[model samples]
Target: MSGTWQCSPAELEVHLGFRESNPQSKHAEFLGPPFLTVCCLLPSFSRLDMDRFLMRNVTKGTTTVKRKKSLDNDDDVETAEDTETMQRSQKISKKNNFDDENEPQTERIETLCQTFSEILTTDLVWKKVIKSNLDLSHTILFSKGIANTVMELLEEEVVYFTGDLAKVQVFGRWHNIPRKQATYGDPGLTYKYSGKETPGRAWPPVVKAVRDLVNRVTGYHYNFVLINRYKDGQDKMGEHKDDERELHPDTPIASLSLGQTRDFYFRHQDTRPPKKLNIDKVQMPLHHGTLLLMNPPTNRYWYHALPPRATAKGVRVNLTFRKVVPAAASSSSNNKQ
Candidate 1:
C-alpha cells in the first residue's frame, strides 16, 4: 500500500528483529515478507499497471513521502493498476487509524483521573488521628533502642547543601540560593545525608512520627520526607501549593509542625475575596506536635503559606512527609527555588 504503515517504534523494532532473524525466499522477497511489508506490487500485474498503481498509492498515502525509482521499468515492476490499488488501500487504512487515535475516550480517561485523585488526597478525619499518633511517637524518640536507631540515621542521613545558594521563587518572589532544590522543592531543613546508600536514614524520629501517624491515620506509606528548619521567626515560606510535577498527582501530602507554632494561613487559589483559614480553624494552638493533612481538592483549590512573624520566635522545624514516586524525577527547572 502507498501510505507508511503507522506503527509504534517498539513494534517497528520487533519487526526489524523479525526481519533479521528470517530472510525471505526468492519468490516472496520480491513482493515482501509474509507479515511486515505492504503488498503493493503483485507479480500478475503488467509493468504499466504497476506504475499506475505506484503513482496512485503514492498520491493517496501523502503528497509528502518522496519515493525515488524509474517508473518506466515496466518489466521489473508490477502493473500500475495493481500498484495504485494497494496504495489507495494503505492510505485509507492510515487515515482510519489516525481518526481512531485523535478521538477522546472520555469514560476511560475520567476513570483514570478519579483513581489518581483518590491516591493523592487523604481523608479529612485521618488528619486528627495522625495528630494523636505523633504524640505517641514522641515517647519513642527518647527510648534507648529508638535513640540508637535515630543516631544511626543521623549519621547516615545528613545531606549538606554547600556552595552557591539555590534559586527559590515563591508567588513571583525570587530566591536564588545555590543549593540542591530539595526533592519536590520542599521548604524544610536541607539535612546532609551520608551517602546514596543511606537514603532512608533521613527519616528518623520526627520523620517516623509523621510516617507512623500518616500510616495509622490515613493508611498511607510515605517513602520520602523533606525536613526544613527555620532558625528564627524571620525565616518563612510564602504562599505556594505543593503541586510540583514530581509528586504523585493523587497522593496526599502530610505536613507535621514541630517546635514553635507559627501562624499558618490558607487561601483558595481562584476565589475573589479569597476564603481564608488559620491555625484557629483546627481549633488548636498550632502547638508542638501538630500534623496537617492536605487532601486532594485542598491543593487544587487553595494555596498555603507560613508568613514571617514581626517578632523573632523560637526555632521551628517542619517536616512534610510525601509518597514520593521517584520515577518522575525530572531535573529541576528555573521555576523552582
Candidate 2:
C-alpha cells in the first residue's frame, strides 16, 4: 500500500484482482497477470525495485507452498542442501572403509606385541622328563587365555610360503606340503630340507615376543624359528631330525606347541628292523603351550615325527626355535657362490 508490504504472492494475488486494461496507462506493458497487477496498483515503486521485490517474494512463497504440499502428501522431498549433506555423508563412510582395509602392517604388529606381552606369564611349571637328553622344563608356558590369544595372533600375522616354495620334493617329484610352514630369524640365515632352501624372514612382533620368552626360560639364545601350522589331524610332519648343518652343534632345539593336542613320536634311528636295539619309540602328547627342549643327543639318535591322526580335529601350530651358526651359514653361502 504505502511504503512497502511483506505480503505473500498468494495474498497479493487475492488482494489485487485482474482489472480491465487501460490503453493509455504509463506502465500498461507490465500489467498482465494477476500477480504482476501490483505494478499498476503500486505506482510509487520503480520498475526495477518492483521486479526484485516480486522475484524474492515469489520464490520464497513457491518454496513454502511446495514444502507444505510435500508434507501433506507424505512425500520425502529432499532440498538442495539436504542432498549435498547426504552425499558428503556417503563419501565419509567410503573413506572410513578404505582406511580400515589398508591399515598399516607395522601398527598391527605392534598391537599384537602389546597384546601378548600383557597376557603371557613368566611362571614356569616343569614337568618330569621321561627321555634322556630331553627337557620338558615348562609344561605350561602360557595359560589357556594366553594360548588362545597367541593362536589368534598367529592366524592374523603369519604369512606362509606360496607357489613352488609351498611344495616339498620327496623322492623325485614335488608334492604339496601337508602343513603350512614359515621361517623367521636373524638376517642371512637359511634352513634347507627336502631340496628346498628357505631364507629366514624378519621376526614379526608377536613371534619376537614369544622368542624372547622362550630364550629367558631356556637360558639359551636362539636365532631361528621354523613355524609349522597343521590345519587338522590330516596335516603332519614326517619322521625326521632337525639335524641341519646350519644348526649350532650341541645346542638344544626348543619346540613350542600351541593349539590342539597332538602326538609327537620319537623313534630311535637305529631301530629300523635289522638292528637288535631294545630302545622303544617315545610317544608324547604335545599339548597346547608345552615347551619341549630336544637336547643335543636326542636329535642325534631320535627321528621325531608328527604323524597324522584321525581324531585330532583342531588346528595345531608348532614353533621350533633353533640356534643357527652364522659362520656355518656364511660358509655355506660362500661355497654355493
Superposed by TM-score, candidate 2 places the C-alpha of residue 282 at a distance from the truth, in angstroms, of: 0.8
Clashes of each: 44, 0
The residue-by-residue lDDT of candidate 2 on 1-337, one tens digit each, is 0001233443222212111111242221211122211111111122222222221122211211112132334454545633443354345334333223244656545543443443223223344445654333334455343465567778887898898888754345667877888989988887665556778899977788889878876789999998989999878775566776778877788888999888776667566434567776666677676777887777666666676667889999999899889888777667766
RMSD of each: 30.3, 36.8
Candidate 2: stretches off by over 4 Å: 1-122, 130-138
lDDT of each: 0.38, 0.59
Judged by lDDT, which candidate is best? 2
Give the Å error, residue 185, model 2: 0.9
Give the Å shift of residue 291 in candidate 2.
Answer: 1.1
Ten-residue region with minimum lDDT total, candidate 1: 132-141
